[model samples]
Target: MRFGIGFVGFACLAASGAFAKGSIDIGRAVYVERTREGVRELEPATSLKAGDKVVLVVEWRAQSPDRRFTVQSAVPRDLAFQRAGSDAIEVSTDGGRNWGELGTLRIGSRLASAEDVTHLRLRVVGRQRGRMTFSAVVR
Candidate 1:
């Protein structure tokens, strides 16, 4: 697993007049099946191939108590977004220019597919091959 801290800072400076600190942590695990443990909680592997599910675990925390946070991460160009685990996430296909829920997002007239996703952003990051980056802000 590779992890990188993209950015961390405060938001809503004009409203609160105080800075809030936040951070993002990222980790990766390749999917594996264990007969006793069942499906989703499989063991972690270092490498993965196509058609294999990879899991990315991200942790976001805010040092301030009363602030809302917006955390985002850059998905590597190679991985596809798995819609099942990402219900609360907002995604972007246009290089972060726009964002929407998975169901409402569209590329041209066609609804966005996992293949069309360029960014999977939420409070968490997905695990994939190569180095990954993540950022967070507290407002």
Candidate 2:
């Protein structure tokens, strides 16, 4: 379940042109879920072990008026999603075909859990330029 050397390559980070008049840079880092003081942090990930938390960083810089756009990143098959930096994030468990909140999405008769998330879509509602992260675990 570890994120091997392959995970450090471009295949592990997905970037698309969903942003309008803007560009995004995506990268992966090891997620330090908590420390002795309960503070979270992110470290460069060279190799990751099973169950290790990984953070997908999506940073954008835009020069357009009303920087409204959507960005989507595909969750690498080697990882299971845990959470998103924004509370209003949407998830897609079936590739990128369908999207909804975890509580409303279903794989069958059961509700989808965070771990079932396959793709993450974030809507930058306004002219905000910053970084957004999604946490996942090495499967």
Candidate 3:
């Protein structure tokens, strides 16, 4: 009985450690305004470790006539871009001073739509230790 209990405890600890090591926490920090046409606001702020692959997911309503949006990344100087999309997004390694196109999200024929989600992925590279900001503009 003692052996069985110890084995189960060891297994539980190992499982938790594995989960913690592989976990990436993504959070949203923004005030979203809703309209009859759609919703609008900046993308949520995210905190990620250096050299971590961060996938940003933005969810909003597309009820407005504006079918266009812009996503921007304000990255620290030390990080390098692995990949990004253009038309819908731009990435800046210099903290929003200059930006290059990254990615795009297509709404297709859907306009004045609501309750839609858009996703973007960025690989986070560690340069210096600090916080960075990212945003999305829908006009």
Strongest candidate by TM-score: 2
Kindly list the per-residue Cα lDDT of model 1 for residues 1-139, writing each as its tens digit. 3322221111101111121331222233234323455645555534444444444444433333444444455455545555525456667877678888766778899897666655655532242222222221111
lDDT of 3 at 115: 17
Per-residue error at 25 for model 1, in Å?
6.2
Query: Which candidate has the highest lDDT of all?
Result: 2
Instruction: Tell me the spans in candidate 1 whose CA falls farther than 4 Å from its real position.
Output: 1-40, 84-86, 123-139
Q: List the residue pairs that clash in candidate 1.
A: 56-127
Model 3 earns a TM-score of: 0.27
Model 3: per-residue Cα lDDT over 31-87, one tens digit each: 222344575443322333333333223222222323222322332222233433333
Name the regions of candidate 3 deviating beyond 4 angstroms: 1-52, 67-69, 76-81, 85-88, 101-139
Q: Rank the candidates by lDDT, best first.
A: 2, 1, 3
Pairs with backbone N, CA or C atoms under 3 Å apart (clashes), candidate 2: none
Query: Residue 8: error of model 1 in Å?
Result: 20
The candidates, ranked best first by TM-score, are 2, 1, 3
Residue 74 in candidate 3 has what lDDT? Answer: 32
Of candidates 3 and 2, the better by lDDT: 2
Q: Count the backbone clashes (under 3 Å) in each candidate.
A: 1, 0, 9
